[model samples]
Target chain A: MKKLFTGVCVAAALSLSGQAALADVLDDIAERGVLRVGVKADYPPYGYLDEAGNIVGIEPALAQDVADLLGVELELIPVVSSNRMQFLEQGRIDLMIATMTDRNDRREVVQIVDPNYYSSGTNILAPTAAGLTEWEQLDGLPVCGIQGAFYNRKTEEEFGAEIVAFTGTAEALAALQQGTCVAFVYDDSFLISRLSEPEWADYEMPLQTIDDAPWGLAVALGEDRFAELMSGMIVNWHLSGRILALETEYGVDNTPFAERMHQLFLDINPSIER
Target chain B: MDGIEAWFLDLYHTTGINLTIVYDAFDRERFLWGLLNTVILSVICLVFSVIIGIIGAWLLGARHAIPRRIVQAYVQFFRNTPPLVQMYFFFFALGPMFMTTVERHVGQMVFVSETPLLTSFHWAVISLSFFAGAFNVEIFRSGIEAVPRSTIEAAEALGMSRWQIYRDVILPLAFRICLPALNNNLVNLVKTTTLAYAIAVPELLYMSNQIWSDSVNVPEMMTVLLFVYVGLVAILVFAMQRWERAMKLPGFGR
Candidate 1:
């Protein structure tokens, strides 16, 4: 048991950049000829399963870009909130495009690429009739939230929400539908998509979103080449308005974050147009 | 406690391993609450399960065939199914059936009137109790059966009623024999309380997850969680062993 715990600790917190024994993960992926990218197959528009049982979404498409750039076959590994970081750390996936909010602490675990590819803010999906216009309305009320979310504590502390965290978005959504909570606090991107769904017709994202966190796609720590390559790709995405185009294709509104990023990048290279 | 907190805070600066539950106010408060909830859940389940076990064991000897069959079926049902699934079933499937819609007062759009008969904590108690109770009933039945038939016949011949003989003669002897097995099962019940974390019970495991998610100190928080559970189980086992020694039956199996 002691040996196992030690191994787990090492696996979770190992600084491969400082280790002499570990090889460059970019070389490993190239040698294997398979760029295994972790994407959220459950989070639609970002990454979700199609009716044909194939994984496809904006993130998966972005993964395809990485694979194409590397001249490797794209392999999309479905990841959720709990396991995405671990999967990248354990060498199960070459890149992680799961909707992980970039945070300082997470930078210690996985090498998050600079210029985050996407951004989302926190909001609440409440029944339209619930009259939950203000964050203060959630005081002493149960609000469903996905486990591992950074905003769970903020919602509970600042808004006085009794955050009932579930292991996954599916479970949180189920609890919300069951009236186990007054509202479901999550990414506005996810909540907005849910509103578009016919099954969630009664529910609406009632509060103005707050805590605008950028989602950083990550690679294993110490993969400097992979990290540098991803940074360039993200810049190109912003420069070319690829993300804005993907949003339109996936039925997501062109968020201010995306538009602003495009304008910022276009300034750097004004001659380039998409 | 302040000194201890300072020590942990210093440890973070030196080693880069943050045990926030020790030093941070928010994390410590919630983690401690989680620990308390786990203890309460386990104890409630333990006491209620034992009661259910004793009643079910007593019913096994009922004169009517129906009650005995019902007990047998219940034992099988709970024993065969996974405890986790049983919890989900109780919370999601069975809980809705028992919900009573309340009248939302004085005007608003549709809001929460869906108050279920049992809360998540209550459902966890019920599910865990029934799961452990199945094993307890079987353990108790074997203990009761081990009480020599001659002793029971002696009570019957003495014109002692069945309930009287069960309460006076059989239970005392059976309980002595049941202690070791009961002790093991109770320990298991305590460990199983961690499952309550899945349903947002604010138990130790759940709170630890919250801490790690926020603090990004997975190894530190996990190591702490390990020691806490080990400590809890150790106390339980120590007490149960002491009880076993105290309740040893004279001239019975050593």
Candidate 2:
């Protein structure tokens, strides 16, 4: 019985040590010489499929920048809102830069590194003629949005707006364009990029951002070193003006979070490093 | 390793069967709501499809050739094309035109979702009814044909009118003969309501997706979804068996 107990103890120790070896995600990526990032291929301006069928967007570009900084090749794994976290937890990807919002509830399953890379919030894009400049004014109005969005139920309950949710962004936006709803409620960052286009010129963002959330890169639980590495790279990008430049390159408007992070990064690291 | 090679290896590692996540991720309210929507959608589709089927069968049995041909064309067109494609065509292409005419007459838009004139619910019903109604036409026709020619001749000899013969002799017999096919069609229709989630109907499948996304428990949510569908289909089959027993013909399918 004593010998059997000792054998069990030895086996447990070996398995625990094996798990510890897999915990250092940063070391794993460095050794592999490739940073696999899960990013969105459906969302535009942040991440999307280009006309050439290649993944091209702001998030993909940021991930590429991270890969370059680490001297590793970038491998982008396309993910949607539904499976991004699972991809991280299961080690399918080393990092998640798929426009994942940092919510407290999500912290249970994955680790979201902060000094967030970017920020966006739910907002309404209405016809300029409607003059809906405030959230309260949406009362009794039918508003269109994508289904399964966290904000859909909130807007309905809080603002008295009727929500007409669609499965796709294209359909939801088309619904707003065709006057199926008085306004289209969606992520402000996406609307900022879309409103720049000629077709969407007639519509205007009428309200300030609601449900403000920061987009952060996430890693599997127990990968603190990897999260630290990611957060540090993000801060360096902000200080070096790379994030602002990437925004311009991608033709997306910079969020307040980016501007503030840049200011903070400059104040702390005043010395010139180009 | 190459990017594709790395991705495939990692995918293989991560996608292993894990059922614990389902227990961790289950949300009763979300699941219940999804089940409710699915039930509502299926019930609506079933009722309307049956009505359309009956009407279509009557039209197909019409004395006039053009009317019968038209009914035949509807059955042929719907049955030949895939249900998914028909749904898309109706929702995207024909839905707006129909809504435009409706709005023009009503002097206001009756539904929201700027692109579709009808709500996803209405479109689900409309598209599903037409799809199922097509098959129902054929099913009912086969049942009507299975009614004995000698029985019809006997009714005619008894000085029965065409309407009386159809109401008394043909329809009742056809109904009994068609019960099994009707049951099968209904079961298929109930299962097909899952597709409505693609159009953002917030049915069971859509709600499960939302829950899994929110909870990050794909395995758990998926397990729950599997059981929900199995339970639904089982319930339907059981109910149908009971119904079949109750409506059994005297000497049929012993």
Candidate 3:
């Protein structure tokens, strides 16, 4: 009786292990009726908690819509800027909709989807009272920034600017507000949004755009089926005019630059009829 | 005369802003605000940790075997686990329970907002204090035990009350002996406060991170950040060393 029981237990354990190995995220999400998405909740106009304390933003909204189309509920997992990819690789999230730039380095680790919706350039935000009209005016002056942002290398190599980097946007803002740096370098859209705020009326982005960088979402490599599904969704959304509708809804349509992005998306995916 | 000099001059002519911008950005008002928040967090953690440490040490140092063993288990458990894990458990797992309890009693009395009285900052302080206190309890307990039993006996024979014995005899000597360990613990506590950034308490590191993400000039920003943190920690170490030296007495043999 003991021998039979031991044999049964070993067989059962082996079967369970085999089943666990075969489990795919796409299948699991489908069965669970929820798409677990990782997003940076601190970033505004992207993924942030609304006034009502609900997670509401562009990426999260898009995630929710995607989940809805898939007939699944949306489960948003708040991720910091640094750890979003780690979360994706570790299976902590099914998809990442954070403002992750599609870089050649990152492409080695994760598969990138087509139809990058957002295009932004780096710019300098300085105090209006600083008399700084150009980037050159920031020479010999400290510039505040975030730690993991890509511009750190370029800023140092190209401009010879003294950079004071913080870990997040809020800290950098506080530093900028406190005059820790003469100027701040960040994405143009973020700079524009923050500068437009009543509290930051004193600050202005005086320099021209530095680089044309496009942003995209990333999924784990080898998940071709899931990637295809995501691409198909984007194509379908573009075709149905839903992408533009979402852009308008999120207030991205208000900017002439973003309107150009909308046209760019249409240009790339001509099959997107609307 | 060198290529580097020309490059530097060209870059300076191109990217450098006016000094007024630096002055405006690093204004005193905002620094004071950040400093105020930092000091408040430190003070709250210090007081709460000391109190918890004393209570925990007393419990562990009790004559009874069972209670002492239980306290030892607690000390070992908290000490063994990472403070970050503890913070997460407190904030995510146990936070709901605490919030519910508070909401039942005081949520109605206070204005209803999204976040309750058990704010993220409060949770950060509470978690850090308890985490630090657990280690402090062991330090204090060892110091208490190191106090010669004869000294306590003499105090007792002289008709001193329990409180008097603890206050006049045990505590002073124990504190003197534990000063070095306690100083180390205090420094650890200050550094550990950086973990509060994880829960979005807007501490120094978090502030820097936010700034970097928004600004994108990470290398320059991080260099400044490294200096700031190193400078802060160095100052703390220097101050503590001075304190330890001042407290030392040649005859006492501490």
Candidate 4:
């Protein structure tokens, strides 16, 4: 039994090493004429399956643009937030346009492409009647939020609000609707999308953006060439206003944060013309 | 072809398998701390639930019908309801009330790292104890009943008081008979400690999830979680088996 196990381990390790050293991803994609991209199939206005089962959203559209730029067929591989990076690192997808937030910790394992595609920030989603006008007003009030969110600890300490965190955003929203908390604290872009739904019409974003986190595309580690190419493509998109056009087409809120990022991208990339 | 290797390969994508992600993302200190928290939570819950079980079992033997029914209701309600729902009820519904009461008395909200850690951890312990205690009640009761009635009669005939008969005679014998069931309950209690992560208790699973999110290596992190739990449960089972052998009442389990 032990010998057989050792043999299999050797085989697996050999295959993994062989696969890693085999080819450059950009060249592989170019040679194959296919760009497989992992995209969220559940989050709306970012990436979600339409009524016809087509993957349609801002992220998927951006993935299509990437494939178009590469002059290859786009294969949309549906991915959730949890499994998207694994899919990228394991070579299941060439790129990840899955609404992944750029953070220093994630940068160690996955190469997050520079020139963020979009910006999101933590905000308070409160009932319109609550009149929660400022951040300090949350002091001593109960706030519901999803567990494991980056802003959970910050919201707790900075605002002095008692956080009632749940395992998912759905539960957090439900708790807020049921008045378990004075407000639901989550990403501003997600809350903005939620506010458009008739069910969530009564909820209003009361506080301005607290902590802005940019969303970036992720590639496997050691894919420096692929990362630089993708990053440059995003910069070009920002300079040409393609990103803002997609935002309008997808009904994403044209927040001031995004506008400023656009200006910054144009300012930095003077060699690229609109 | 072997079982372990096949299982390991199934954890990754079929085209290529990389275990480096696991090696790279592994945080020895954080994982050790998480393991410690899990062990501490499980031990605390096990101790409290055993206490609740013994008290509950004794009360269940009461002559009065009302108290027996109350104990019966507690055992029934807790054992039947999902532990996850019970966790939410305690964390969401009762947690704020507890904080308010504390604040009312102290004139300020007590916090650690900007949140009420004590209150949340308190609720996590309370929920787990009550949940497991319900099952332990039945286990203990059956253990007590399995004790030969002739032994109790023998202690009574020796002019032993009720408390004496229970403590010196009945309880010791009952524990011997119930050792296997009690060990099973303790193992289950260890497994259920993962549920504490849902309430953000920073136990093993919660910390592992934090690492996985930060690293974006779900497969690697999940493998770590699975092995950590398996190791924990194995240690508990091994310890219990050793203790059972040491305390083996000859011919009792046989």
Give the winner by TM-score: 1 or 2. 1
| TM-score attained by model 3 | 0.49
State the lDDT at A87 in candidate 4: 94
**Top candidate when judged by lDDT against the true structure:** 1
**TM-scores for every predicted model:** 0.74, 0.65, 0.49, 0.57
Candidate 4, residues B52-171, lDDT tens digits: the string is 999899889988998899999999999999998898888777664433322211114332212333455678899999999999989999989998889999999999998898789888
RMSD of 3: 17.9
- Candidate 3 has an lDDT of 0.68
- Deviating ranges (above 4 Å) for candidate 4: A1-165, A173-185, A193-254, A258-274, B1-27, B101-118, B251-253
Q: A158 in model 2: Cα distance from truth in Å?
A: 5.2
> lDDT at B66 for candidate 3?
91
Q: Find the 10 residues in a row with the least total lDDT in model 2 chain B.
A: B101-110
Greater TM-score among 1 and 3 belongs to: 1
**Model 1 quality (TM-score):** 0.74
Model 2, span A185-270: residue lDDT tens: 89898898788688988778878787778887888987865665666677667888888888888776666677777887777658
The C-alpha lDDT values of all candidates are: 0.86, 0.77, 0.68, 0.77
Ranking by DockQ: 1, 2, 4, 3
Instruction: Summarize candidate 3's per-residue lDDT along B1-254 as a digit string, tens digits.
Output: 35554554465457752211123243223334444666678768877887887778777756789988877887788888998888767755565454321111111232111223364577889888888898889888878888999989999999998778777888777777887798788778877887876555656665555445544545755676566667766777898788778867676642
List, residue by residue over A1-274, the lDDT tens digit for candidate 1. Answer: 3443344334324433334355687677778999999999888878888999999989999999889877899999999999999999998998999999999999999999877889999888987768778887787788889888889999988878888898888878877777777789888988867876899988778776787889999999988766766777787788889999998998777777899889987876698864
Record all residue pairs in model 2 with backbone atoms less than 3 Å apart, i.e. clashing.
A175-B114, A180-B114, B22-B220
Displacement of residue B81 (Cα, Å) in model 3 is 1.1
